[model samples]
Target: MRLIATTWQPVWHETPLGWLDRYRAALAEVAADRDTLVVFPEYAALEAAFYGTVTLDARGWMQRGANHFDAYCDGIRALSKDTGATILGGSGFARKGDQIVNRALFCAPEGEAWLEKQMPTPYERALDMAPGEAMPILATRFGKIAAVICYDSEFPPIARRFAEAGAELLLVPSCTDTEQGASRVEIGCRARALEGQMIVAMAPLVGEVPGCEVIDVNLGQARIFCPPDGTSPEDGTLAQGPRNAPGFAILNTLSESLAQARKGTDVSVFAHWPESETPQNPPETRNFR
Candidate 1:
């Protein structure tokens, strides 16, 4: 299946309407090819907050009360219907009654959505966004897919659970602040793909937002990960924005080459290393070998 990963370079301080216009144009440009599945990065929807006084410790700033968050979801629904494309709508503050959750919306061409991202990172905890309880693996014509936002991918258990639940493709929507941040995220993407024996696609926000550290500098990087046998295709990368410019990185085909690599031989080099001969209950060293 063809997957188009859109790494947005949103100006952090723009109004919702302004952002909508820019995003709509970007989406139109990226979706020029009708049959593509597009994925946006985290926080691309709330660029305004980045330039504001919203700190990780300030819960009030991150609140997305029912009416507002619902509107966002409604907009996403419309986007999916209009584009006739499947979208992993990145991460956002979703309200459920008086509580909020760090959530991702996966909308199919039929205008139906499946929400995921059960766990929020420590940074998100400041906003009092509740962690999700269920990790859903979606079934699509392309493959069995699952999505996790930013920090969730840092944890091995979460990726493992998705793999166990039969997800063949993992999508990650991230918002990171530094080039190092991008590197770290990309490393995790690779690790997840290798360990799960699946394809991993990561889209990160690539522009500056005045107040937020990540958005204020040149810190955006996006990449796709596959198995190492040169069979899964190259890792797709998107621009860092401003100087580099914003655009989409298209994965023309979601190859199952990684799975093929693991069929007869261990494709994970780290897992295949010779085991150490140390005893299970070796005596404690006391200045002697």
Candidate 2:
């Protein structure tokens, strides 16, 4: 399977049509082949509001995104169908009854599946966003795929659950505002790959768009990683884009890649995880000082 991820940049669309065209072009660039999966960054939907139909204030982005969410999402579904590739179309704020939640839109050629974010960042919570129940694992023609949105990637159990469920590719769609935030997310993605022994792909939103306080001053890049065991790349990185640059980080994964990770010559993080979960005696504490 070929994986492509976008280091997307935030920009103002003069209209909703412009937003759809941008996504269409982005997906079109890499959808020429079969068995390809592409991902965009979290809150990519927020960019559509810059056209002036809604207020650009951070306080109002959630509502604006909710109002215009489904229509833009339909456009993404059509792109997936037209390209014949599965797409994780980033995330957006969608109204789920009285509460508003951020959702990851995963679309295949057949249809669309929405995954609610299990964790919300401080920034998102401050903006009055509610989190979902848990991360989701979606089965695909190639293999089982899963997603851990942005801050959710920081949690080991979240990624571990997907691995336990027989997932192979883990999608991480993130949007960050600072160097620390970006590095933390990068570290989380790498750690999850090592622990799960599954390919972890991250696509982030970059650049600053004036008048859009929600996703302005974004950070991070598109990167793909796997376990550093003998069977995979020693550095654990399969592909990555230039820092904060807008482009796609593309790579191919063998169907046997996950199989190799567990049986490879190494510390066996994935295999040893279950043993670590077993009940063990507490570490002996001593007063050395």
Candidate 3:
């Protein structure tokens, strides 16, 4: 399977159609291959309100997002069908009844599913976005896949659960304003790939769109990683895009890549992972006195 990790830049427009066209263009570029999977970063949907239909401030964006959430999802569904490619359409605020939740929409040729962000950042919490339930291992034709949205990728157990559940690919969609923030996400992606022995791909929101308070300043490169073990690239990075650039980092993976790696490698991290989870005996009770 070929995957495209997009480094996207948000821009304010006078009309939603104009901004939506840019998104369509990006999807079209990836869909040209048909079988390729594309991943967009967290908060990519918030860019729609950047057209100024809603206030450019954080509060305004969230409110408008709630109001227009359906249209946002419908558009992605249409794109998925039209392009004939699977897409992880990035995270956004979606209303789940009375409360708004931070959710990422995954659209495949077969169907669509929502992967809620299990963890919320301070910025998101301030916006009253609710945390999601535990992640699920998603089944797909290419292979089983899982999602670790933004900050959630930093937590090892989230990816570990998915891996144990038979996920071969991990998708991480993120947004960060500073290089330091981006690095933390990048490190998390690398770490997950190393320990899980699966393909980890991250697409980050990049560049600045003035007036969009929530994502006004963005920084990060889109990249794909695999285990550093001998079965895959020694460095673990399969592809990386230029920093703060708007483009896609594309790479191909075989159906048996992860399976073969787990079975053939000198060090079987995936197999050994279960041992780490073995219940430990109660700690010994001893007093220095």
Per-residue lDDT over 1-289 for candidate 1, one digit per residue giving the tens place of the 0 to 100 score: 5776667776744355555556567778765334667788876655534443455424444552223455565666677777777777756666666777766678887535555456676666755678765447777776778888877788877887788677888888887776777777788888887777677888887765555442355355556666665443344222122322476767665544324534533355324422323456776767765
> Clashing pairs in model 2?
none
lDDT of model 2 at residue 275?
88
All models, RMSD in angstroms: 4.7, 1.8, 2.5
- Which model, 2 or 3, shows the larger TM-score? 2
Candidate 3 residue spans exceeding 4 A from truth: 31-33, 53-56, 254-256, 259-261, 279-289
lDDT by residue (18-117, candidate 2, tens digit) is: 8888887777776634588888899887766558544457767778878878876887787777778888887888898899899867888766678778
Candidates, ranked, TM-score? 2, 3, 1
TM-score of each: 0.78, 0.94, 0.91
- lDDT, candidate 3, 1-289, per-residue tens: 7788999987777786666688788876666445778888998887666665444567777877666656667777777777888888877888887777888788888887888888898988988888887556778876788987889999998888888888888999999999999999999999998888888899999998776687889999999888877767778788887789899888866465656545656787888877777857756889999
Off by over 4 Å in 1: 12-16, 32-34, 48-58, 64-67, 211-218, 233-245, 255-289
Taking the candidates one at a time, how many backbone clashes does each contain? 4, 0, 0
* Winning candidate number (TM-score): 2
- Where does the lowest 10-residue lDDT sum fall in candidate 3? 47-56
In model 3, residue pairs whose N, Cα or C atoms come closer than 3 Å (at least 3 residues apart or on different chains), thus clashing, are none
Looking at model 2, residue 12 earns an lDDT score of: 76
